[model samples]
Target chain A: MFDKAYSGKRLDRDDALALFNSDDLFGMGKAASFIAENLHGKKVYYTRNRHINPTNVCVNRCKFCAFSRSAGEDGAYAMTIGEILARLAATSSPFSELHIVGGLHPDWPFSYYLDMISEIKKAYPRIQIKAFTAVEIDHFTKLSGLGLRGTLSELKSRGLDMLPGGGAEIFDSNVRGRLCPEKIPAARWLEVHEAAHTLGIKTNATMLYGHIETYEDRVDHLMALRALQERTGGFQAFIPLSYQPISGAIDVTRYPSGIDDLKTMAVSRLVLDNFPHIKAYWIMLGEKICQTALYFGATDIDGTVVEEKIAHSAGASSAEMLTTGEMINLITKAQKEPVERNATYEEVSI
Target chain B: MRLALHPERVVTFIVDRNINYTNVCVNKCSFCAFYKDEGDEEAYIIDEGVLMEKIRETISLGGTQILMQGGLHPALDLSYYTSMLQKIKKEFTINVHGFSPPEIAYMAAKAGLTVRDTLAALKDAGLDSIPGGGAEILSDRVRSAISPRKINTAAWLQVMREAHLLGMRTTATMMFGTIETPEDIAAHLEAVWRLQAETGGFTAFIPWTFQPGGSPLGRTAGHATAADYLRVLALCRLYLDNVDNIQASWVTQGIKTAQVALRFGANDFGSTMIEENVVKAAGVAFMVTKNDIINAIRSSGFKPAQRDTFYNVLNYF
Candidate 1:
């Protein structure tokens, strides 16, 4: 019951299931907003970060390969370290974060990522680098022939910062086998995040919903992430990524409705109490729905991302860039105070 | 998301008592059951001793204001009202939020004075603020339908306008769910909004449904439901944007609905209401203590703050 959750009691599987099944959508949203307000006051968090995909070339081409390409593909491109640094330098506005996530390039060595982060840190030491996903980390571990812990530590020491929660498509094994057969399994993703948590590196988590996933599958995926968060307390935010059927593999014709997006955000806020933030990624949910999301338990609207490629490649409709003023305007219109945050969820005073 | 445009950090309540000074009436409103005939045995005006004891009780309970309202008694003139307020101010250091516009208008008419003169006299007698009672709907057609003898819409607005010109703040209320239409509601809101825009003296807006069980008018065929109440409440929050606070009528809506109303845009919980008789006379009474209000707000995930009649927060619980 919401009364139980309102009292700060830990919700169980049944409670989450009931909430997902309940018809009182407004009630659930109010309860979630109440909890969110208590945690963050009236402030909605955002980040001024650049989303740089180092390389879109990958070894394995999964069905949902909108952003990834095979080695011989004409559109496949890889940014050299010099190009990456130049791109970062060319941006007119300063950013507090460098969000890097890309394909699992088989030809590139793990040292390439290590050097990229270290070079970025050396040049822009003030910028917090939140790079790589659990899948990408798994790729690095396999490519380097080292244990996951050693690979993560090596990367962390070499200025590889926190993980961005991508590639966490629906964690159900059946759905995983069908959608991303070549990617790492759900357990490996959890294991990589757990290892990262042990190293005191806070990371975000995501769930790909609205395609080929049942309500139970979604609940199960959320519970698994919740269980991990309960142990580590290291997830800085939970993002429920709505699936975009922009590729040839999926058969959906319509995007998730605004109600579905809002419900997903609200449910994630309610289900993941241990996670400090729930983000409404404007790149995926669009601007209107994302603005409405503030009232439905979304504490963070990801940011004024200067150049985001992954979601845009997958048919995201939001602008590729938004000014910090525009982001604040959107939040202010929603009756929330906007707070700029860094990769680790620290409020950026500047 | 932000719950309010202003996004007040804490929800507020007032630990006040509603003190009805007299039940004797001159205007027999059909919707009211509390007022009695002048010669009735139960129709007695509160004496100074009883009034002082009530103020002492309120002060002992940590209350900061006394919400004093009563019927438009036939024999009581303007002097009686002023002397009573002067006596309370001399004896106690509490804020006196007394007299609705209807009572003030009635006294002005009885004393053969203008509304402005009546308000100035009352203000000089330590009447700090006014309550928004008897304002069923600011439409004369609806007012005539509800209770023909009650002051018309113009009289109510004129009294409030005059009071504001005297630098006195007041609250505005609506009693809906009887026989009014959507147009009636809009007109009522427009009048309140326009007045508020001109004077900036309205501190809050409160809406309560008409309870007909114990009324001489008998039970009405229909009334606003809980969902209807929420819709109207949210609409009030949107329409009366200049009004700083919108209260949840917990006295009529019950405590639970009031808790949920915090999300619907009600920032204040109205009052602790150590004693209330107007709504009780209509056959529904919801009792609440200071702790009850505090817990209700806390359970709804808001910081509970105690406030005075003027909307100044006195304490945070």
Candidate 2:
């Protein structure tokens, strides 16, 4: 019983559910932990990359996000290539990888993003580019009036290395309709990533936490990713993003939350044990908790983020920059050796 | 873990901010509003300089601990955290309350060390205590659906258990009203209770509702009402007999709910975060003043005292 997946245990689904439904905290924790130890041997993973969010200007203002901004907001910005490069250039050392994910700008064609990646590659040939999430790809393809294959090929040729697993929030349209009503639906998010990986572009996946998502929604989210991972083997790692209550942008504050929402964070590590690397993103969770997250069942710490704005656009108040030394410090303090990896978890520069 | 022992004292307080450090995550919960995908043109990773500065600010404004957290990005490693803790301890005398169960879990796996070893290293680096992040609903059913990549409830407990067994202190938290039933919440409490019972390490138990925004889930119409929050609070106080302190979430239910929580079971006020992100990203707008928190607790019939991350009373007001 202990060796099998909880789903496969001898306990009747009813009994398991009842056990789950039971108020016995210790029993339940023991049961869950028993499963955890059996699956993961107690290790976590982290990364060493920087997120360069060049703009906040977007066409799809998903209600679930407090980060996106209309062109008119005082904070709304579309940083020029020079501005972004200048900021990224200040990174403490040459970043091993460059992470790029952003909104679906209604006007910016796919060429704009492709140009950015191409220019980045041209400037820093050693850096691996993990740019564009599934949503951005879908949005780009739609704007470019091209097929998924064609779009991916064109982007890859222009130095687009891989994709970041974003936009596959919940595969359930019911939930998607309520949260991000206008963005690409679950299938679209999947198709784009599938296309990218089919083209040999590896990607990373993520989930947003502390929101109105249902348990089934989370299960479906993972299953969808797992299925895709099984199919293309393109997903490199999985990360969990905590929801912030950004008031003015999307009105997410009307809800309630605290640290307990972290159940979502832990469960992800437990359930997705099959996934090779799980990251504790420092930017959203803060350095302290991110450091601590390693013990539970995580492995990656995202790299030296040079430029980022989404969480801040919503309400993240932590600094947007950390020296590579600082990155190493977080890992060392957590008592782990920081092994820097590129977009694909392949050692780039550690 | 040793037999569980509820702290000799029971102190509860009003809850407030869930101040996350970064939204640039690798673990993207379907329900999160805080994380921005790489090219969303708004994605960001928090700055360490600002974090140090915020620690100073939180300490100055009579703040106790900073609830620092972020997404699972792959670049940062153990060294990054050690220095942060070192700096916090070096700069200010504040309790360096940092890291959650999952974050600890991450380090152990990446460093290829045992949980105990990882925690020991963190403690030696000036880590004062652990905060309960990544314990969403405690039930696997809920976790798998929403955050499959996060450490599961059992693993989360294992880390806490290991931490406690090693004499590292911790806190417990719950975010309800999303996909879980009362039983799930109760089970969540039981997980903490059992761990606290075994290790006697949990300093406090905080239960709050889910805030849905920027997530794939629909917009939350109305959160668990104030009365609902109190009911849960009361239940936590009553059922989590092993955990000594209960906290009210002002960040969720507001000061009024926090005030009500004191009567239900809360004995302490949560952090006055000089900064918060995740909940704010979800679109919530709430904050607390040190004076206001003390007044709220005092009015609620408990003597107000400020405690650091470890529940060590810093001062009595």
Candidate 3:
């Protein structure tokens, strides 16, 4: 299996499944690390970004979502364009990207979403706006009475530079049924992404693991992403979100252990051979495990997210923010060179 | 290099229990989490009966040795250590691999005897060998920063040299990832390699990371990743050519990284510690049974063998 990976051969479904079941974690890690080094050397990429979940008032109450709330609920919110601009202007530090993913607000017209992107882009023309998931894109298509390609083209023209990888929770239908039945099916999610890619918008991909999903489900999800990337070549990176065990909604009782987290990261790096990067999202994995993941085939540790609410709503215990200095310190201590990057992963020159 | 030295593809481990006799100490090192003040409620010297019970339990579980170490108590003398060894030797047939260099230096000073004389007395009372502890970085610059009240580097080496002259085989250890530079690590490995060259009394070279969970250094010092641990482990194997054994530390790095350490040039699986408290007190504990060690070794493509204190194979699993 390692020989195949070393020779630059494409790993099939069986090869990925074997990697998932094998106990040779270090062997697999070494192979992944070697490939990462060959591609990027010791340079680890990070970004100075802010996550803005404009509102938590979502119509579809996905069973695994802890961030969404009903319209009349106590904690539900709907952020006007003015409020989002004010929040962005209040930040003192400079950032290269604004990661905007929010709940699907039923009452807001599709123009409200389009105006939100244009307003932020007009104000901060230098910062890229990576907004909306395929689920939200599907919601927009319904709200605007347009086709998938037309909705995505509207978002693209409104300065939506890229798509954030959310709502790709698990591509398996069985697990998706139990996880978020009201949300779009796997076919619709794939169709939305494919349309967005065809329109020339690069996007990130994600998989929510350690929940009710089986190893086969995870491999199937990766293979689907691989197949898509092979055709469109639209994925900028692959992010594996470790499922944080919440109290009431999700039935999972515990978080994934460090071994499982590292293995998932390593396997993703090997199987997603077409992906340019594998991100260890520190918001869910914590600082130590994320730092260790650098050697397990991870080339990027997401970003210095100023404020993250989605994972925190699900009971994540990591710190709310890490300064750029802190991010460089973490990467440096792991003996890797830290590279500050923009939304598309180009090195951000000061 | 590992294949050249250990051509049999056999990895070795010893089944032992770490019995810390006393926790009361005067030299309150900043990086240590197991030491306590003399009058603290948790501070205690092990009762003789409880100590005997621990040894009996270890023997019943197929353990061949007891790794006895403790804090530098101000009131204990040479008589205390000699009588403890005599009592244990008189009772059981287990090898008593006890006392690190710092403890020996302190006892010699308190007893008004040379280190050689002190070691001779302890050996006569059935101190079979010595286990290396308290040698954090083998550089006075690092020792002064982390443990100013403890022994200096020269004193630590002097104690080891005297023990070696007395025909006692001891192991050498380094606790890094705590305010240490690459030069300090190189100096540490060079120190061990030079000593092994001179006396050839060192049995193994064990290197582990500093756990900064419950210690004072936790505020300023960060933890080392498994990559850092493996990098240092591989460096130890390449640099210390005189030392025949390089043991991987499962207690600090966990079992997965330790299994990977075998490929990083480690030939020994360290000890199957039936009971461990020092690292546990620092808020990181990884407990494994004898079978777990054997299985980990076998799965890593090596034969797991049980060895005595002197690295003699007793059984191959």
Candidate 4:
């Protein structure tokens, strides 16, 4: 079974299930790492990027969301275009990508998102503006009565370079129904990514695992993304977001064990073979686990995220941003060469 | 190995009995509760008859080797060990994986022999391979503090290097999680890694946390958590890239944690000890059988293969 994955053969559902259920964790890790090394060598990809969440006011509050706030709440304040520009101006450090995603603010019209991205692009023309998630796009379609195509094309015209993979809680409707009933269904999430792909807009995909999701749910989620990648070949990377249960309706006391985290990382790498990269988003997984993740088939450590708000709001202990030197040290310690990448994964000099 | 080559979905374990010949010793490590003073009622050495009986029992149970490590006994001369090995080899057709670095160094010093000559003599006396022991942490500062009378870091490495040059493959071990920082752990791994790179004689590397149960260092610093164990285990696997096998200590860590260690870079599940005394003295007695290991490896989605003392696969389950 591992020989198949080792020989660059795509794993089927049974193989994935066997891997997920099997305790032969090191074998799975080796296979995943073989694929990773074969594809990227020892190079560990990271982006020089900043996360800009312009607002927190969301209409549909998901149970797993710790960042979203009701309108008029104490922390609920949308950044005006000028304020957003000022925030962007505060960083003197050169960055190559602007990762923008936020709550589905019902009051903000679709033009607001368009103008916000346009203004950022106008200011930083060279920086790739990977803005908005599929759910946010779905919100825009509802708000402006523009279908998915109309909303995505409009955003793309206004300097939206790529879609930041988010709001993909879990693909299993049984799990999603309990955690995020108001959020877009799994079908809508896939359709939105597919629509963006058909328009030739490159996007990343994510699966929020490790909370209220079964192993079968996780397998289903990864398989769906794999199927989508087979169809479009547009997913630049697959980010397995470990669910942070801060301020969520589905309350749990424990985070997933380090074993579970590494298993998920390894399995994702093995399962999502067609995807070019698998990101260990260091914001959710702290620097320690992220460093260890390099061996468990993680090719990308997300980025030097200068001020990420989402994971922090959910009790993540990592700093909002890691210095470039810090990230380099981690990659070097893991015996991986640190590579600075743009939003679309073009290797760039640090 | 799968990482070095293509991925193979097989995990191996050895069926061997760890025969502790004598618990009575001269150098009592602060972390060990297994040793006894010469006058203690519990300080009886294994008579030749009992030793042979244990060997027969091990062979009857389908064990391929006998791992004999013990406290450095002051009264027994080097002949006691050489004759014991000779007698075992003469009587039983079993591989004798005996004598850790500390034991070798102690015996060498007592017998006025150099480390190299000592290893040559032992090899002639049917010592097939060396088990990695007495390496609590290879840093001199940690070694000086915990086991002051035990062999120092250099002496342990010297024993291993001389044995390797003599073409005797040995295992490397680290007993960590006591009064050592991350730097100490890294230093221990680096020492073993450097030696392995040079000689390439290490058959496996095993790292287990210090059990502070009934030791003189009892419960002063809490035992290492499963996370700590796994982190170090993963780091050992990543760092000691030259070592062929990374063994998980199911005795120190329970079977479940050891099972999880398979994914974290443990290829060998270590020995299926018919009897173990050191860790049990530290208050952990996780007895595992042949079937227990086989099922654990198989249920974990790996082919459970049985190996000899030198990691040669005898058969696959």
Q: State which candidate has the highest TM-score.
A: 3
- Name the better of 1 and 4 by DockQ: 4
The digit string of per-residue lDDT tens for model 3 on B61-174 reads 788999999999998899999999999999999999999999999999999999999999999999989988989999999999999988998888888888898999999999
TM per candidate comes to: 0.55, 0.54, 0.71, 0.59
- Here the TM-score of candidate 1's chain B is 0.94
Better of 2 and 3 by lDDT: 3
Give candidate 2's error at residue B61 in angstroms.
18
- What's the true lDDT of residue A165 in model 3? 81
| Local error of candidate 2 at residue A264 (angstroms) | 2.2
Clashing pairs in model 1, backbone N/Cα/C closer than 3 A: A294-B1
- Name the 10 consecutive residues with the lowest summed lDDT in model 2 chain B: B1-10
lDDT of 2 by residue, A30-102 (tens): 4444444454443333455778877777888787666778888777878767776777787666667788887
Cα DockQ of the candidate 1 complex: 0.01
Residue B277 in model 1: lDDT? 40
Quote the lDDT for A69 in model 2. 80
Best by DockQ: 3
Candidate 4, after superposition: displacement of residue A53 in Å? 1.0
User: Candidates' lDDT values, in order?
Assistant: 0.83, 0.67, 0.88, 0.83
**Fraction of the real A/B interface contacts present in each candidate?**
0.00, 0.00, 0.15, 0.03
User: Residue by residue across A293-313, what tens digits does model 1's lDDT show?
Assistant: 787899998877889887888
lDDT string, candidate 1, B169-279, tens digits: 999999887788899999999999999999999999999887777886656533455556777888888899889889988888766567657767888888888764433
TM-score, chain B, each candidate: 0.94, 0.85, 0.96, 0.94
Task: Name the lDDT of candidate 1.
Answer: 0.83
Candidate 2 docking classification = incorrect
